[model samples]
Target: MKYPTFEDVKKARETLKDVSTSHWVQDDLFTWKWWLLLAATFLPWVIWIKYRDKERTLEILCYGLLWAILASATDVIGGESLLWGYPDKLLPMVPPLFPADISVIPVSYMFIYQYTNTLKRYLVFSLLLSGFFSYIVEPIFIKLEMFALHNWAHTYSFIGFFILSLIPYYLIKKLTIKK
Candidate 1:
């Protein structure tokens, strides 16, 4: 059997435009959780856009993308490993709530970087803040039935997330410094 090339795949998709308007609407409705998650995830970016200086916005966007990728990777791993699960009501997918884990967490890191230029300081604040949000705030989500933890225990996972946040903080500091 032969695999389709990118162009072939695109052509196939274009030719197979059998999607109905009702199906599109249903898909949109099904993805409402994703939309809400996106809004919540982007709230930090919106705030940053309003309050942040123009010079730093690009830098923050870069860092946000980096952290978002990392967070998404972690979410994929965690979900595949049965570490945690999100409610069907809260998300259309498993583990991550419409990429919120990736996007939101990274933006939060960008906020820390914006305020604190030093790696040590950023790491400290990032760990504390992420820890608080992951441990205290997120457990409430678990309790409220928004999500469920499978194999991953919250105590260690919370600490792990705090440490994980430091990685990007240190990396950003190193990359941003002038030689």
Candidate 2:
């Protein structure tokens, strides 16, 4: 078995450094959409901090990370398929996935999971959240030219959002119930 050495990591970093400088087709910064991306990235942390004491912090964070990874997974496919895209990014240095996918969306799911305890409540809130993301949040980005839909529609988004929303909730429920 072979493991990468320290020098290998440094060389990899140097090779990828050009990404921050010019790898992307567009790196719109300080624009309105850029500002919104920044807000989307940090606002969730603020919201989470304000309500920190109400839930199991570790479990909630785990759920949030799960949602982030799920979002990233689907996001990679969507980006590759050209169904949708983010034109304005908060950080071009990172993967093209939105920062808010990791922060805002997942944190929002964590809150929903904490509040809605029953499967019935979970279903209701999940649908509401799915609609909120598909109809409201996605549209805001579409209007701002941050997210563009090519072959995608809000209908497709509702399906994805609804499924993704419930995943963390059920996962956490199963995990904590055993303990």
Candidate 3:
């Protein structure tokens, strides 16, 4: 019931760091999952860059950046709360699923935003995309042992992703200059 001293906290942190390093070396590094994560980290950005609307590049990028920030923050909260976690990491450090949070999610959402010119289309795409992520994508990650859900369910993810998509869309809609 007593608060731990800073020294104790440091010791715990060091222990975790050592364990993460060892686990990465023995189980995570150079594995097929790691290679897949590497590809996932870069490939979407490449495709997004090539196919994105050239005229609205900056506006679209702003939307993507907002999504990245929100996704990364939510990932951290989920991991910290033991709602979900990543088993295979590209690195031994924290924010284990950088590819999904920083690259894939944002880039994919950005495409949806750029392509959907109307609110109705955006909502429909958002709902479908959220379902795809929560049901199909998450199940695959669970099967692959890349992601684990301790106290969360696909329905929660579905709702969360759908709302996350709409937030950026609506905000960007207001922020973008009228033409």
Candidate 4:
């Protein structure tokens, strides 16, 4: 029933950090996942170049960073909890949450946010994208062995990703006037 103090949380994070960093660098350096990771790495910049002048810098920053933080946190918790995992990693120097969390999810949501003007439109588009990721892309990743689902499924991803994409839009609205 007791909550962890800041020091308790910090100590736990430090331990997890050391363990995860060691395992990643020593056991998972520069392999095939790294190559896929390299591609995942460049993909956001490519998308950014395409949309660079389309939106204000502050809008882009808030939208992208909020999603990135949420996605990374969830992916880490999911993986560390053994609910699911990205057994094949892209970046060995860091945590294994970046390929989708840092790159795909945020960028994908940013695109959805950029185009849609109304909540109705955003929700519809987000639902479609959620289905695409859950049903299409995730299954493809499963086939390619890029992703794994132990106790999780694409259906869960469908629901989770949809909510993930949608919540930030309203949050951003509350925070700013799209500037």
Candidate 5:
């Protein structure tokens, strides 16, 4: 079997990228699901802005940024590993479900961090939030044909969500500069 050359692999990748772009334009762009995804991408930030703690805005935003990084990275890994996928995309150039990674996950956890003042409260709320994300939101996405899971399950997602929310909070708590 002849292995493809680097240039050949690059050419194939470009072709696949074009296919994705074309598919997005033809099948995804401006569809109802696309509109929903667009709203999901932006609406949370609006809500967050309205509700986020004014005094702790910077700290909350930092936690959100960290969660976004972790969520986006994990989504990329999961997609690449064929553990899950998004059939419809708001933008083909991004991770399949960037609205979730970039907006929903971060915003939800940021709110939890902002509202939950004690470690016990944080843990309880975060666990509940993770369960909601894994069991409720994910199923809704699957029903809408937005997301699919292959080599994964809701339990795994629950664990991932829990860790993703917890790590950032602890890191922020540890690193915050006392005035």
Candidate 6:
């Protein structure tokens, strides 16, 4: 089969403009609501990173980056599916994908990983943390228009995020053990 030409791809992208325009709005135009949500989402990460061990700071940063990507991917998919949404006012004038929600989640996970020593204990704690965040913090976000759940209402089902977090933790532990 012949590949589509650049012109054809350009036309297709233009056609998709309406679907993507909301993501391109000016960032500095944020409202008070946006600032409040941003503070709540980002402050904890800043405080935790400040107190983190110097030697392990790089490790935590790396893990934070990885989990940020994971969370971004999930957020994108969820946004496309109408399972959730973020207000355009909440994002800064940067990469369209750079939202506060994505930035915060991985750092939170890194904090959990750093504070706990054992996999079993970390897993349990992480699950509880995920449940609390999902049930409590997320609903407030929902109210603030940072996100919107579609067919599925948010619940304390830490199983999914726990499993997602477990994979990296397990791999990290195994590699550290081997070394």
- For residue 100, model 4's alpha carbon misses the true position, in angstroms, by 1.2
**Where does model 6 exceed 4 Å of error?**
1-28, 37-42, 92-97
Q: How far is candidate 4 from the true structure (C-alpha RMSD, Å)?
A: 4.3
TM-score, every prediction: 0.72, 0.81, 0.97, 0.79, 0.96, 0.74
Each model's lDDT? 0.68, 0.80, 0.94, 0.79, 0.94, 0.66
Residue 112, candidate 2: Cα error in Å is 0.8
Off by over 4 Å in 1: 1-38, 89-95
Model 4 spans > 4 angstroms off: 1-28
Q: Residues 24-140, candidate 6, lDDT per residue (tens digit)?
A: 344324667656656756786778768887888767776666677666676667666766656554544333335444566676788888889887889788888788767887787
Which is superior by lDDT, 1 or 4?
A: 4
**Which lDDT tens digits does candidate 5 get at residues 137-156?**
99998998888999999999
Sort the candidates on TM-score, descending order.
3, 5, 2, 4, 6, 1
Over 29-95, each residue of candidate 2 has an lDDT whose tens digit, in order, gives 6766677677878888898978964548888788889999999888888977999987666777665
TM-score of predicted model 1?
0.72
Please give the RMSD of candidate 2 to the true structure: 5.7
Candidate 3: stretches off by over 4 Å:
none
lDDT of 4 by residue, 1-179 (tens): 99999999999989977876777677567877667777886788687767764647678768888999988888888887887776566654455758778887788878888888799999999999899988998888878777788898888889899888867887898888635
Measured by TM-score, how close is model 4 to the native structure?
0.79
